[model samples]
Target chain A: AQSVTQLDSQVPVFEEAPVELRCNYSSSVSVYLFWYVQYPNQGLQLLLKYLSGSTLVKGINGFEAEFNKSQTSFHLRKPSVHISDTAEYFCAVSVLHNQGGKLIFGQGTELSVKP
Target chain B: GAGVSQSPRYKVAKRGQDVALRCDPISGHVSLFWYQQALGQGPEFLTYFQNEAQLDKSGLPSDRFFAERPEGSVSTLKIQRTQQEDSAVYLCASSLAQGRTEAFFGQGTRLTVV
Candidate 1:
């Protein structure tokens, strides 16, 4: 019923450069959006979440994403990234159900920052 | 515990063998979740538990997969007759409440079926 699409399978950027990871979702009803980051051999950590708030959401590590309803997009952006920012990013959606909300995730985008 | 913890950081099983993955959620967490992450793919929800009750299990890929949170604090996902397709990282997560709460994740157990 609900699905997420991440346009970029991988993104390579130089250190101190700006980067954006694109995400789009298709849902029939209202949804909650989130971005998660996973470093090598570690669990996923929440970067940001868009519940019922402003379109622009700021997250950890100077990352931000704007929820565009019309475009069905929630693209993650960073003004300047460092070498440590290399990780896999995922876009996920959750809709309230009778039991509870379950997360449906997109195919992740691997962000590679080079010196 | 400070965060969700999963046991058997790595497991190697021969094809057709059975395997069991364990999860220890944060104490007092009301919600626990199980997910499967394949190579180069995001984690996929496998099941959900509220306390000791299994509220949702629709995401399980097959009947061979079984899960239980008998006491609510600890949960286990058992796979019978493991196959190569079942090789993946099994993640365990916990949340303080049922809805709209942040879910904390574990490092995950990497299962490899040969």
Candidate 2:
């Protein structure tokens, strides 16, 4: 079983300021990590994912996440944020060996970018 | 590309009423998944289907909740007796079934049980 935790329920930042959304996971086996964003009244869109080979994963909209094995953390970050980047962010994990593995998601962090 | 799409973007039902939500995955995607998202929460896995076969359903909350993807393209989630607790946005997603591919999602159907 795998579980994800996004420490911040809500993060408020001014436009052009850097922001980081914290995510941590617990899993007994090797896993894959992912970050997703959801706009108002929309479904989740894949922001980034961390599989094998690379601990640093980049996604669309200039966002990126670092997967830390020792810390069990995969935090999403961007050098700067825009008002358009305001949305609900989620972190998810999937089993690497379990073919039937399903994504387990976090409670979510609402990123509010104010101008 | 036209992303995943769902029908009846919003639905309202009285308690004990049956409701059906529909999802259409991207064309030719082999894997489909259903999730439930309560307001202010992330989506929770509900079920998974690979092709026309149901591979997993561990996340369905109750026997009243059922999902089917008969032809492996469009899927339907049927709630036998909708309850207030069932009020949430039902999301559908599809992936390539290849290595490390990301899942694309539909806008989701919001079910309101009054």
Candidate 3:
């Protein structure tokens, strides 16, 4: 079985400040990592994914994440954030060849950007 | 539709009643999935279907929960004798051909059992 753990349940930051959301996974097999953002009453939107190749993957809205194989971590980061970026973020993991690509998600971290 | 679509954005059913949630995946998508998201928690996998065949259903909480995708394009999750524990957002997602492809999500149907 695979699982994801997010270190923070909530993260508060000021506008234009940098932010990082930590995620760790436990999987015996190679896995694909992803970051998703969900606004209140809305579906989840893909932020970024780390499938293969580069360890550093960049995603939409100037967000990025690094897949550290050694630590089994894929943490999301943004150099600067805006008020519009406030939302609930989830870290997910999927086994490389799992049928239907079922995603195991973390508890989620709520990001609140203040002015 | 441009993306995955779920109907009845909100549903309220009395305890012991039955409810069915619908999901419309992207056209031509070969894989579909269902997940449950409780308050303040992440979505948990419930079931998976490839084409019209249900490949996995191990995540279903109990036998009372059932899902089906007859033609593969649209799917439905039926909860029999609904309970308060079944009150959560049911999300549907689909991918082009499965594997490592990105799965687009629907807005989800929020089911509340009173």
Q: How close to the true structure is residue B1 of candidate 1, measured as C-alpha lDDT?
A: 66
Name the runs in model 2 displaced over 4 angstroms: A96-101
Give the number of colliding residue pairs in candidate 2. Answer: 0
Q: Relative to the true structure, how large is the alpha-carbon lDDT of every model? A: 0.94, 0.91, 0.95
Question: How displaced is residue A41 in candidate 3, in Å?
Answer: 0.3
Model 3: which residue pairs collide? none
- How high is each candidate's TM-score? 0.98, 0.97, 0.99
**lDDT tens digits, residue span B1-114, model 1:** 698889999999999999999999989999998999999998999999989989999999999999999987899999999999999999999999865888889999999999
Stronger candidate by TM-score (1 vs 3)? 3
DockQ: the better of candidates 1 and 2: 1
Q: Which regions of candidate 1 deviate over 4 angstroms? A: none
Q: Which numbered prediction scores highest in DockQ against the true structure?
A: 3
In candidate 3, what are the lDDT values of residues B44-113, reduced to their tens digit?
9999999999999999999999999998789999999999999999999999987689999999999999
Interface RMSD of each: 1.2, 1.9, 1.1
Candidates in descending lDDT order:
3, 1, 2
Q: How would you encode candidate 2's per-residue C-alpha lDDT over B1-114 as one tens digit per residue? A: 489999899999999999999998999998889999998888999999888999889899999999999998999999988899999999999987832678889999999999
